[model samples]
Target: MGRRDIDESDFHSRPTKRGSRPRTKQRPEHSDAVTGLVTGVDRGRYTLLVKDPDDGGGDGASGEKIVTAMKARELTRTRVVVGDRVDVVGDVSGGEGSLARIVRIQERTSTLRRTADDTDPYERIVVANADQLVIVTALAQPEPRTGMIDRCVVAAYDAGMSVLLCLTKADLASPDELRALYEPLGVEVVVTQRAPSDDETDGANSAGQTAGGMILVPESVEEVRERLRGLVSVLVGHSGVGKSTLINALVPAAKRATGVVNDVTGRGRHTSTSAVALALPVAVTEGSPTDTFDGWVIDTPGVRSFGLAHVEVSHLLRAFDDLDEVAQECPRGCTHLADAPDCALDDWIEASPEDERPARAARLTSFRRLLASRTGSDA
Candidate 1:
């Protein structure tokens, strides 16, 4: 689809009463008050959970204010994300359970995105302001597949978001053995069980330091609250990865719906067909501050495919930021490693000063090895 006819200047400020002195004009106050998070989005319509006026914590943003079914036509942008913080107007009460209109959307920090494919130009933003991408995997009825995890890593790295590998249903499999595969990569790998106890050394860092990071919660809602206390995490994986199960477990009545994994194909049917955000049970854990306030788990539709088109070659390089010194050696305007010719970075290492030459060579060698693994070229 082409860009919607949202005039880029629609949100732009016009000539003010104070000429040459530019300032954003406030909207009419009669418009419904309060900001809200886009709880659910579908068919160009969004359901908003507006925060209470006095609740400034931003955390503990209870759904005291509910506005539902805002249309896309009224919105400035055609697309709406599940976790987006938006400005709403009119009938904010959602009227005897009727919907409200989302007048404006606040700026988003980072957008979780993907392209249709290498040939596709349109950028699809999955969820905006997502702090973490939790790639959930299970080890019981459905086996763990690292390919799915790798794709999630690529997406997370592309968005500059941290990635967490969560292995669920650990009792069914040796969770420790499974976690060992990813722990070496320096990525945070969490092992969760159906039964979480203070007795068992709980490794999940429920310490709420930032927003938009992911945590793996077992079948317990208390565990979800404890682990995902104050972050905006998007749980993604193949169908039957226990994502919806985890969401339903986290938020008491989230009602995301769960499907049974096929004993043959080892995949579950799509239960939650679209990305939807729900208020997590913040009051579950009594002692830990993880049960403090506002947090949401964006349970997205299961993925059958994940392509890297939305990511650029620059993304791959930045993932290994420790080796940027070698990156500068590539010829200017050179196609890094794929589908090109004579763009040698080795020449830079060979020409460097004596003392710096060895370090450059080492970094360049390491960079090349990594680059070769990704691009399948020894350039």
Candidate 2:
């Protein structure tokens, strides 16, 4: 679940439409509608994937993953985002594509979006309902930006998702030294260290094999694939952070084009084309049997700058839940910034000479700094 709020009623409500289609072409009513996940969005339509709707109520699920074509006219005004679990009202024949009407869109767990840069013309939704935000950074070449990592972590925290830091190219940089920057923030830091283990080594050599979570990968496609098992992870980083390289490595046949970090400008050339999800299998444990579609990985385009002015200051302070109590002590209408006249608990801080008001003040200052640096109008 995430904190990004959305209008609930609109989940299935389609806007008033004024178009007519051939009634004779409409297929007969299906027995009972089943749910499916929206995996792809294209050409004013959606590609829905549904588990078997027959068998023992949901039996024969082995070959039930069907791709149905859905249009906005039938879905009303509902904008179906990727990962949307929708109920379809039509034949879901897997072999032959059939027209579908998105009758209902199940509530989402979260929605990830970013304000378009000052140069861009519109807001961009990276993906929806992701549980983790992974910031993949490199050690050398383009270099790591603590500022960007901090922003992504803050966004994850504000959006109520786990934050992980993945440092690539450890061969060139000291993982211990570089990882220290985010280790204190409780972020899971994955460094490119250690050789592949027996399982990882074996899996790395095989094209399709079961793997575990967070496996050590050393220039091995299989190792990377196994590590991503059972996760709804979204990768965020600069252009040259090896997001696409890593994706291609894990899914060798993906043939995802890779680009070099601009030597002169210190930026990554865009690859991957568009943001899309790659499903992964989760390692089965205990009584639960393993199956496909256990996890998902979403890759997005590179960014030079990530402005946080679109986010609220209250949301920023909330990132550190441990410190929220102190913020609650603020005076009514407190901006929580330095030297505010309305901080109700000002006397408490002032009485304690050793207290660090500067640090507390700095946290609130981030919003102002974001605004000053923001482009165009965001308010």
Candidate 3:
């Protein structure tokens, strides 16, 4: 059969002009989008916990659903992290194979950030909208590094979030030294002792030496829960600090993999690779369950170091209210370090009552230590 005359118009030799229509800057408002809490992120997919709008104000199992989502093209340059409150559209039903699109990220109330090290200039946002920063450290085995804890506290303070020092493995070592180190800063410290397992025996009643010759009674997971019941707390620490173990204990269903400290290196194996937010279960009191607690815990992967290259030394003062007040009296640009000429901190410490002089000195020392850490100097 003779081939039909080719219609040149149907087959263009050159590519047609794409995007022929003018684009408008106006974007969809997505007014119907529902607000969701980012629970996890893996690759390009996000896991969001969205509450049912029709369920009234109650937060029951049926009132909430987990929806898998991905960022929309409009937000390609915006980074999304766990604990972010995002607005999602498209398929929001928590069903198999259903995927939603994140249209907008709500303005973050707080952001926990860090850098690769003190010298790195790029800031890495660790978590968004977290109200509390839990600095977990092991009392023994891997041993606690005050340097990392200081860096974490600085980051938290810079982010304007409250700090909580979670000292783990109290049975292995005493938390006294560490507690004394942070006490002057007014940081809330919670020491935890893992109960003896079936093969272990309770030793010396798990009592440990603390500051001022006082004994510290280690708290259990329940006590930790009480501290975190109503806040969004992020757990951060180097490996072997028991962050994953603590998460498992707090939310039994989390089942986060726990790692042990390497006998030779004394470093913990990186078990959790990414950050995830887990909802705390309702507390059981007096043989009854209550639903008032709506706290969430974000378990982050263990890190060898929490860099603070992005933190400003001046911002660290705000964390110490007492020191900040005295610092105001110093000359402009006063670093408040001991060597700053005519630094008001020195005069303030001297003028302090004799009984309060020791505490004032310690606080000044602690503040300087953090400032020095920013510039890679030893206190």
Q: Write down the TM-score of every candidate.
A: 0.69, 0.67, 0.88
Off by over 4 Å in 3: 6-20, 57-60, 199-219, 284-293
Over all chains combined, what TM-score does candidate 1 have?
A: 0.69
- Score residue 44 of candidate 3 by CA lDDT: 95
State the lDDT of candidate 3 residue by residue for 258-364, as single tens digits. 66779999998998999999887655333344444468889999888778888877788877787788888899977777678999889998899999999988888
Q: Please give the ranking of all candidate structures by TM-score, highest first, separated by commas.
A: 3, 1, 2
Error of 2 at 40 (Å): 2.2
> In model 1, which range of ten residues has the least summed lDDT?
202-211
Query: Comparing candidate 1 with candidate 2, which one achieves the higher TM-score?
Result: 1
Which model scores highest in TM-score?
A: 3
Tens digits of per-residue lDDT for model 1, 68-156: 75743545556778888887766676567666666667898878887655456788888988888888888776888765566667678
Pairs that collide in candidate 2 are 14-76, 14-77, 15-77, 55-59, 56-59, 331-344
